[model samples]
Target: MLHSLDADLAVIDPEYQLRRAARVDNELIYLTRTGGGGARFARRIRRAREEVRTVCGVCGRPGIPRTRSRTVLCDLHWHPLTAVEKAFALSADIPEAWFTDEAEIKNDAYVARSAADQRKESANHLSERDMADLLGVTVQRVHEMFEQELLAGANHDGRVVYPRWQVMEGGRLLPHLPVVLRAADGIEARTLQAIMENVDEDLEGATPAQWLAHGGCVEPVLQTLDQWWWI
Candidate 1:
């Protein structure tokens, strides 16, 4: 026998055992009771596991439970040392265990290395193409970044739109950068394409989000303004 779905588009069997469920907006208004809640619970657990699989930004690996604490370290790159470990490290007699777990030393090195890289990258001036190249997303996507108001920009009608200086000034609230950069530079399509190529030369392959996150160009723009407050 065939069964018809409701106007709400909820599917269910003859017994209404919740075979399906749906949500509108934030509300779960439709539920089909075909089998049982066990199936739903199982699905929920699967989703939870998938969510946990996300990698931590600091460590570049899947998040995992750590021996130092009960809290899972799947996404936490900097695992705070326990009081015992802290005291041991600070003590005149350092524990040999601290040296044995090369992982702890590795974390410190990661932080130092990342900081140095950031400093070096921040010193460089970004051309239009340099900005475009690293962000693997298209020029249109770059424009969307501006539309989203992530970055402030100044109009250069006859010229290129440039990002506003405020984006990186005094380490202030960094708005979404595209809007600001586009406005400041009044950039054209070709200039953006050039940027993409320049970035590819250095990064090999990079995503738009990665380019934005690197945040070197923004800081330099702000620093340049320090000389001329007349604007």
Candidate 2:
């Protein structure tokens, strides 16, 4: 997605002032650059300025970063003296309260990483010309299909590409794709694609795509999405 990554999208985190707003990956990190200079502490806790990026502002780790402050963290230090993160935290001189037994951060990281992996798998996709030829439709009709949510297409760079799974044998559209597409309305393309590919208990252990591919009922999939993805 083309994000402005502006001040409006940032958050003033309690532990780390100025955080990059959660985007497609649902990951947040400190915004290191700032304009004003004041009391060291005031400058310390403000939300990240608009210059933040995907890498950690400190050690350049993923979401987690290494810094003198107890600001950025990874799952490793959820519990003090527990994992390598704890050791790193201790060395960084962060407060013990910064550590917790809750594994929420780890879980979120896993989820984001899994979604990213799914995106990579779907990256080798069909272009507009490919879709038009396969469906025996004009390229203009293909654009209409995307606008109507009749097809699943994600924006990579500045262009939109349709994932291969959206088409079945002989270039036919995947089963129930139109239904799922409508149900998934308003969600960004990459996330919608990930939800379709991710496994869910409500789908009887099948991913949405797989369940549909097997001729599963569209209602159950929609219901599952109500409680999960679509919600």
Candidate 3:
């Protein structure tokens, strides 16, 4: 019976074939035939259509195909700046044709979003007095720590503001705060803040601040910073 069905299917679809017959319990049985040639081609076309019709990665809405790789993105998330904008934003010379590469555009989008997130996080800053109170030390002691490079801060609107992540509850700094500060010495405060806030793949997706908070080793973190030329 299976042979009869297989012969009929082969005649109807020239690209289709069936094989692999076996005997089981003295009964003739056939192995499931794989989808080949025309059937497989049809399946691939269907899958490509599905991929093109999938939802956007950034938003839940249905996406329009945006790249040769068929990445789907909505209008809001599909915004790619021109080469001039990219060059200005990245402070580097970039060719207009560079944006034609989908990978480069995706990377630029990721970097832009990361920078925006870091900027938002950095807005939560602590003044010297606030830092001193949080650490249970005098304001002058906070200044001394900054001068000694034991802590880091940035000037905001004529007032110095420290990143709140540097200090923990119960008047203690992060366990590896000094080590990170020393390694990150001479790097700008904004860059250092971004490094601390960004998730490190080596640390299993934990931010530097979270890793140190949970008693992670500092050597690995320092090594990562060193590789980035931050040390």
Candidate 4:
């Protein structure tokens, strides 16, 4: 019966068998004997069906879905898998055990560290009202300073907080604050704070904030900030 079918197919198309057997020669031969191909063709069909059914959970586009446990991501999001994992970990409702890869574990660790740093920064910061009271001005004035870019404030859990290092006990902003803010515009708040708070060897291990408090020259700090800001 198989030979009769092959003879008829050959009459219709001389290269029919060759074309059918182009890649899956063994499967084609198996199909000729069993009237169907076996595991190889079965697997291929299953994969094809999955490709057709799957869609990206994020963007709703249809494609091959790569899974990380319960999370289904398409190729676009999968390429930056670590960043996706980090974002998930940072979410308030995420489970602690969702991380599956070593890279994800590392990202979770980094996120934890960042959260801790933010908490510390928040603890050391002053609210707008508190800053206004300290500076003997209205809260509206403090907001004006932020809007004018004379002082930098960071959003913490939806509230804007000003770092303590930017203000002195006498309610005066650091003289170099404007220069640093202008030079480091568009930089992350945490990064800008780190730059201002880091101890400089040139200043005998005094942080830029402390050096400025002691009336150190703003030129050196501005020069150093310009060098590091681009990097």
Best by lDDT: 3
What C-alpha lDDT does candidate 3 achieve relative to the native structure?
A: 0.61
Candidate 3 ranges with C-alpha deviation above 4 Å: 1-123, 229-231
For candidate 2, the lDDT comes to: 0.57
What would the per-residue lDDT of candidate 4 be over residues 100-216, giving only the tens digit for each residue?
A: 466455544534544464466567789999999988999999999999998889876577888898998788888778887897787656556666777766667888788898899
Once fitted onto the true fold, the runs of candidate 1 whose alpha carbons sit more than 4 angstroms away are: 1-55, 58-80, 83-100, 126-231
TM-score of candidate 4 on Cα atoms, chains taken together: 0.50
| Rank by TM-score (best first) | 2, 4, 3, 1
- Please give the CA lDDT of all the candidate structures: 0.37, 0.57, 0.61, 0.58
Q: How high is each candidate's TM-score? A: 0.24, 0.51, 0.47, 0.50
- Summarize candidate 3's per-residue lDDT along 1-231 as a digit string, tens digits: 334445555554565533233221112222222334345433433343344356554443566656533345655456777656667745664344445567556655744554554455445678898898888889999999988988889866467789877876676799979889999877767657656776777789898888998899998789766644221
- lDDT per residue for candidate 1 within 1-231, as digits (tens), equals 012223212232233333223221111222232333345433543443343334332343465434221122333345566778667665856444543457566666755554554443333333234334544556566456556655333233233342323223333434444443454353333233223222231233542223444563544333222211110
Tell me the spans in candidate 2 whose CA falls farther than 4 Å from its real position.
1-54, 57-122, 229-231
